[model samples]
Target chain A: MVDAGVNMALFAVVAVGYLALTIALGIYGYRKTLRNEDFMVGGRKINPVILALSYGATFLSTAAIIGFGGVSGQLGMGTIWLVALNILVGLIIAFIVFGKRTRRIGKRLNALTFPDFLGRAFNSPFIQVFSAAIILMGMPIYSAAVLLGGVNFVVASLDIDRNVALFGLAIIVTLYVTYGGIIAVMYNDALQGGIMFLGMLILLAVTYIELGGVVEAHQALTNLSPQVPQPLSDAGMRGWTAFPAFGSPLWYTFVTTFLLGVGIGALAQPQLAVRYMTAESGRSLNRALMVGGIFILVVVGTAYTVGPLSNVYFFNTYGETSMQYVGQNADMIIPVFVNEIFGGSLFGELFIVLFLLTLLCAAMSTLSSLLHTMGASAGYDIWRHVRANRSGSHTAEEVLHGHDKDLVRSMRAARIGTMVMIVVTVIVTYYMPANIIARSTAVFMGLTAAALLPAYTHVLFAKEPDTRAAKWSIVAGTVTWLFWGLFIQANNANQIGLRDALFPAATWPGVPYSVIDPLVIGLPVSTVVLLAFFLYGRRKGGL
Target chain B: MLGIDDPWIWTGHLFAIGLTLFCLIYGWLKFNDDGEDDING
Candidate 1:
């Protein structure tokens, strides 16, 4: 129905311009870099405004935009509840509860990375090394998921070859991040966040106009019968005015997949944890909270709201269910909606450009942070021990100082690690058999919740968490998630089996249905382990 | 004119209202910082 040619040309020009701007920013950031601190933590002097925007940019990515939005389109407006949670749990509680303490402790210890902080906190090099290893192993899947989003959007919007789009996006992000490091990534994230905010507003306005008014839209939806689209009808696809039926499978997926996966998980993210360390003071972190919260509200709130409304448009025009149009890939729904809504208009072109910029910004910012953490963990934590042991130097000061290098090598190592991660991610993406965004995010966050949440919670609340207990708690949590994820969940016949039920629509025959997600199973296990370890340590005078 | 039967539009309004309310709550919490400054250091 829309003119595809005009849309393609518009999107192409915008994409090219965005790519040029990002490269320029990367080069500019590269020239300004001075030392290890600057390369890794931006010299711990990032302004509150930029820090706030960059945090928001990194937090809400293609995962929030396309993936969650697609789920929202199916789940109705209740998805907005998750958006509210993102601001409250992800942003507010994060800034007030965790950010204040993390910044103070990180500054006290002069720790520039997540692993560095943990290593210093417990005075154990092993914790740092293990934490880094976990991030290196788990984070690539998330990165791959983001990369897939970029490729999918570009291919869909511009009608380009998927392979070309994938390669082009990956190369652009890698080059900028490798060159500029965190500084480039942060500044670009601010710009990308601004674009995302504006683009979503325009898209929302246009969508409203297309649907006539709010009242008419609701009545139209309500009038439709469940038999019209049986899955949607059952999935709580009432007139968009009503919430989904209580405890519907769609409702469960909406809550677990979008809400809990992102909302509660944001608190445990290592990438965001490092941001708390970037600010000059707790006050700076406080200032960032407001800016960050508003940005997330606009960006994430709009995506989730607009995603479901798209179903209405799709169903009406094509006489097909929105899910049918979405096919197996839930990530494609938003792009399809964009093309449907603005395919030929100038707004459409701008939307595509901004959207691609959003993806690039999200990928680069998150990747750069993850790489910096990986490098710090590897260089300062693991490699330091290896080098010290080999040279027979066991002194604590020497062990710490041996790994300390000039900023250039550290930066280069981070970039190299990033490249390695990218290759692995690309391979995973190419061979990925399921919904990369939802599944990968769920896995990563669930792992974090299981492994780090208990320790993190104790660190925040308890005056003195027994060191023995803390160490064992981390081990217990990490292993529990890994056991459920790899052994129990992975090997289950229902999910990821020969026929391949990716999400396990039903519980495994023998496994308790309560053990649905690793987070559900692992959280309680980690808590019990931590408590048991703590009590035993107290009895033994080991606290 | 399309009658008041289109659910997506109403949902959009609901979203707008809900988000606005959320923003207000967030603003209040962020701005009204009670004097509980326990420095971890």
Candidate 2:
């Protein structure tokens, strides 16, 4: 086995190499980036393949590999459905269905951000400011989750202090993003996505080999199902291979929160949506579909599939399931598995460093994108619009077609906004509970879906999406979602006043209430509101 | 009730693959029609 000293030396070498390469790319992007538009949208000339991989990398992240992987270790094979959903809805529909329309509209409007697109498309500054506010406010929670996922792995692998690791990671990510903007973020994302793909493939192979093979490992897991902890069995978990019992709490949680929530929610993710605007044309977007789909499959598919299989390995070696073996917090299961499988030998130590690099790739790629989006939303969309509004003579059109000098100021503000987001994310990361990455990711995605999906869908596909309809839809989605999250989901139910005021004895009652997520409630409400408004507007005087 | 024999899962996989193939073919045809003139920029 490689000693600690030697392992540290190897780690330092790989870490420094990765840092140097990413920084060099960032500098290269900075040099090429000319206008504010170029920084925000890569001059609308990003290579489709690069865009595909970058989008996939940013979408999956450590949340999939570590957070959701750990969930699958406990929840079992059903999670593969999520992988299938990610590819189908997240990649295929996203690139093929949404990408083409978004590109045409965004390019025509010269819309620089997702909020900017919405604002311009609907002719509603409210949509712009509100959507940007949602991103700025809600995205920090997701960013915190991503930061926590990356830092937790670092802490577990290197035996480092968690706070120090979090701070250090924030600084590194902030510097790259603030300086290089979207151009640098996407460039680095392509590199990170490559590393993530290779790492997942290797980890998948190593996991299956360690547990014998697929059939053997699965059979072993099935045989051990009776040993499933009482809490899980009570919640209707039959085994990892089988789906949870219909209408059970676990079933509700899995299908509602993890599956439908994230699956449908992905369509409206601001960061991912912005990617659609980056591609040059519908052809570029279409060309990206296959690459993006496969990347999602390779990264997400392997992580989730291997997650359930880890149970077999842990049961044989540690005489417990992967979740139990990792202790109570299931989020650490993937990291712990990495340590145990690849910890002892010299080659194992090398693999550990590579795995760390993979985690960094996943974390940094997503972090940079989310931070960039957050920055642009806050600075470029919200702050600038407010300023322009306050300046009495400036109409929205005049603000939109501002003088060239204003572009430089806006870009500077975006950098400052990026820095601010980093600071907020670090603070939030410090307080986050373990294993919240997947839940947090789902929450953010669902929130985006609720808040923006209906209006966004109408704008893209509708001939003339009614502005009143779009506004109502956003309100309905956000309200219903917030209500459910604050008072219905068991996780957040206890923290809200409604729990104490109405259901002190029973929080989040009913099958739907306890397990059915905001997406189910919020999305339909938003859609109905949109339809009602559209019909009303059409009947009244045409949209 | 579908148990491990759930057909929907398989259906999902096939559908996703189909969608991907469709995109690839459509993109190839569309770009081919857009032609070699503006391919680089």
Candidate 3:
């Protein structure tokens, strides 16, 4: 229920204040954004702290906290391994191994976007356009889901009209993104990131305090293993406190789908990768690494830790698992816990509204960045390239240095592109079923990994990047993952329905290759193809 | 170790802390080093 403490007026004052601050920042970004470079790459000199926070905010959308947090609530704290991966791979390897090189080369190539980076690296227009096309095609489903996540939360918490929240949220975020571009996105993301960090830290402290300290709470949770649901136990989950049984079905899933899929897939994300370009130099990103890592840990680690422990709280209070209280909806676990944590008192009431702001920050931060990426894919990558090729304009220097008249046209096109993509995302949100988009994130991640990662990594590291091999490798990965997701990966195939539409006898995925993530397959397929070409090229002295 | 028995789960927790420190120290160490390149200016 909407808290009695949180009336419309209180929320109104808070929301208005928050929006005012956000718009003030946007205007600041607008004033600072003089050239196209400012709009696209925050003039390639954004503060390290802002860049790091922006990257974290963009990476961990509202769906991640609520969705994955709920999963940990249901499945257990085993998912916290993703936090390790987020730091080890997502931040450390990403910033040190990949971020520095991507920034250096991106500057050298005068690339403005992820697709542009890849394209200029290979000197392949097809690579740039096709990569952008993949983003445009794949990202909308995820963005729509983010929009839905925010809208649904607003409807439930504030008791506002869903349509109003959806449109209101979209229009506000889209305005800043279109006008100020990445400068605004990064600056606003820093504020959102701070809010998220504060929210998570509060929840963590309150949770531990309520549970009588960390060890006691965990012990309480560990003692409740006997309350495991029959279906989950039978499926190889031992308990909430322990790992799923070795080599069990649950083990396969936790390892393949969430662990490797999202853990590695994070490395290839276009929105996150673009942040590497906004920093001034390797040293700036090096500085960003510490802030980025801690931010990720505080937010993601708190969710995973508090999630499983919630079982103890609920069981102690109501003799029910976290699942039982939420009627088996994993997404509600975190929200319900938050509402129940600080219930009834005046301070609790105010904190409830503050937590709601965290949700708003999470949603808008992610959505704005997604909007920015989609816009760049459309305007700067696809449209600009096509137009420039035909009209013989946008020389790399012109676009990079940002002094030419044509650059203004290009920037205008990007603004138009941001508006168009935001509308597309909102339309998708309006039409697509929530259930479908909610489950589509992993599939979307796998798709990006499959189609882009191998080629992207090759261009970054390879001394003589073979454009033909890179092209074919991308095609091979895209085709392989598409075929897999449609006909092999159980969840996606079932959603797409083509596999069973034709065959009609394929059972749900389990115990075999169907259970493997598409990225696991797609990345290898692309890598092997590239490797073969690499060997052949070396033999022939062509690459 | 902290009331959870499974070494696996606790190891993940420890590793998360370890990696965060790794990033913090690395960044701190590298914050002042501009390296041999990007120095012509």
Candidate 4:
């Protein structure tokens, strides 16, 4: 496909340049960081462009590209609706409807982290610790999912050994994140976001050209409609271009898990929400809304669009669907497409370098944000809170600023917690099965929405969300998500071990299992609990 | 146009891209015109 010597030389040069720039940014951020505020939220002065880029880059990782992109390739064009919803709901609603008050109150409350903000907003340390606990428990699985995408690409496209690539990426990201904290993450994310944007645009152009143009490509896809496997066609797949029949499993999977779960679920993401606290004023958020929207449209839209279109290109070139070409594992579709699509072309070697670097940038940018959030939760939210309690500090403000020791000790603890979580994430990556990246990502996102969204929305928009309701909402969300995931979602139920021995409950018997995701069940149940508690609190004059 | 035959494909893609541009332009104009100095202060 390519000349090994020339390609490796170009790749080496590009990789070195990319690494040098990322590390240099880490050093730059480290120098600029001084106080706890600077380390956690960049002293609340990040410009709009950087904040928007960083947020988008973190939001759309290799999981969106390789995992969901692969899912789009497997499932068809229905996933594009997720892109529409991402911009409209994920960015527009997130930045405009939620961002203004979040920044305003976050600043007024001096909230440095998401957990800190939750604790301060409702005046409850339990909320802070509990939210941190959820992040610490759930985020590593999501991070591992992101790592699988990057490592899979490295192994498949770059011809690197899987173990070496996995550990190597983990080590590099850990160093920079531990050194520079959130500031370093944001700086590197902005650069990575740029690469991802250009890379996706070039890839999309090349894909359309390779397919002999869009009309012919789609026509060819229509021609290949009968080639859809019997089970898929039976399950309601009409073709690559058309949506599945209503009330089908494919429809449920696409609508419930991918669309609703990732789209609506994005609002409650801790890492994404923390971005609101990093800006100087509401103006930064206002400016970011547009920048972030476009970035999402490009990065996420390219991934989902290119994913299904890969089927057209693959069938044209190899007489097989992308899924058939890559065995049963959909994760290999995008990497295989990149490897084969550019083969023997004049610029094949150059696109390969850009594509590989772009995937690395996407994965690292996201991993850094997740790990930073986890570290903050563990060190500041849990450790500092417990220490402050033991030392006779009752309020969150006291714990946040009671003694000089708070800042110094918590910073050290944060770095240590990050290192530990890095090791955990790498180990988890080894055990995660193929084709699980997108599903695992959806699980985390759905859990966040179920557990945090109702309470979080209440805190930002109204004054009625108090300590009691907040606690009940978190419990309701987490419990329902876990219960539905274990007893209902087929994939998750199988993992809980000895369902016969544990609960003696059969897997939910229906299309798309009992429910598509926890968001549907957990969200409604949590909302009901939230309102009930809010009313009870009002009656008792607790609000 | 790339001659994409499906109206849905092009229409959806164009709508998404158009909405993104609208957001960027609107945000830029609002930021510059809204007395950002006062907001920051």
Q: Evaluate residue A171 in candidate 2 and report its C-alpha lDDT on the 0 to 100 scale.
A: 81
Off by over 4 Å in 1: A1-12, A19-51, A182-187, A222-252, A390-392, A395-413, A487-515, B1-36
Error of 1 at A255 (Å): 3.3
User: Tens digits of per-residue lDDT for model 2 on A364-441?
Assistant: 767888998998988888777777778775677666544566667777888789888888999888878765878888
State fnat for each of the candidate structures.
0.11, 0.19, 0.68, 0.33
Model 1 chain A scores worst on lDDT over the 10 consecutive residues at: A506-515
**Model 2 vs. true fold: TM:** 0.89
What DockQ would you assign to candidate 4? Answer: 0.33
Best-first order by TM-score: 4, 2, 3, 1
Off by over 4 Å in 3: A1-5, A23-55, A160-164, A179-188, A384-413, A430-439, A505-510, B35-41
DockQ each candidate and list the results. 0.18, 0.21, 0.52, 0.33
State residue A188's C-alpha deviation in candidate 4, in Å: 4.7
Residue-wise lDDT of candidate 4 within A1-543, one digit each (tens)?
A: 221212566678878987788778867766676444544355355667777777677678888889989998887777777777788778778877777677777888888789888888888878888999989878899999998998888777667777998888887677656554544556777777777787888888888788887677766766777888889898778777777778887777767788898889888889878877665566666777768878888788878878888888777667788888788788877877777777555488677777777677777767887888898899878999877778775566677533676878987888788888899999999988777888888888898889989889889766555778888999999999888887777667776554556767554466566547778889999999988988887888853
How far does residue A185 in candidate 2 sit from its true spot (Å)? 7.0
**Per-model TM-score (chain A alone):** 0.85, 0.91, 0.88, 0.90
Candidate 3 lDDT score at position A145: 74
Model 4 alpha-carbon drift over 4 Å, by segment: A1-6, A21-55, A180-188, A388-402, A498-501, A504-508, A512-515, A540-543, B1-15, B33-41
Residue A393 lDDT in model 2?
53
Query: A387-442, model 3: which lDDT tens digit per residue?
Result: 76677766643443344565567678777887888889889878755334335566
User: Fraction of native contacts in model 2?
Assistant: 0.19
Q: Lowest lDDT 10-mer window, candidate 2 chain A?
A: A1-10
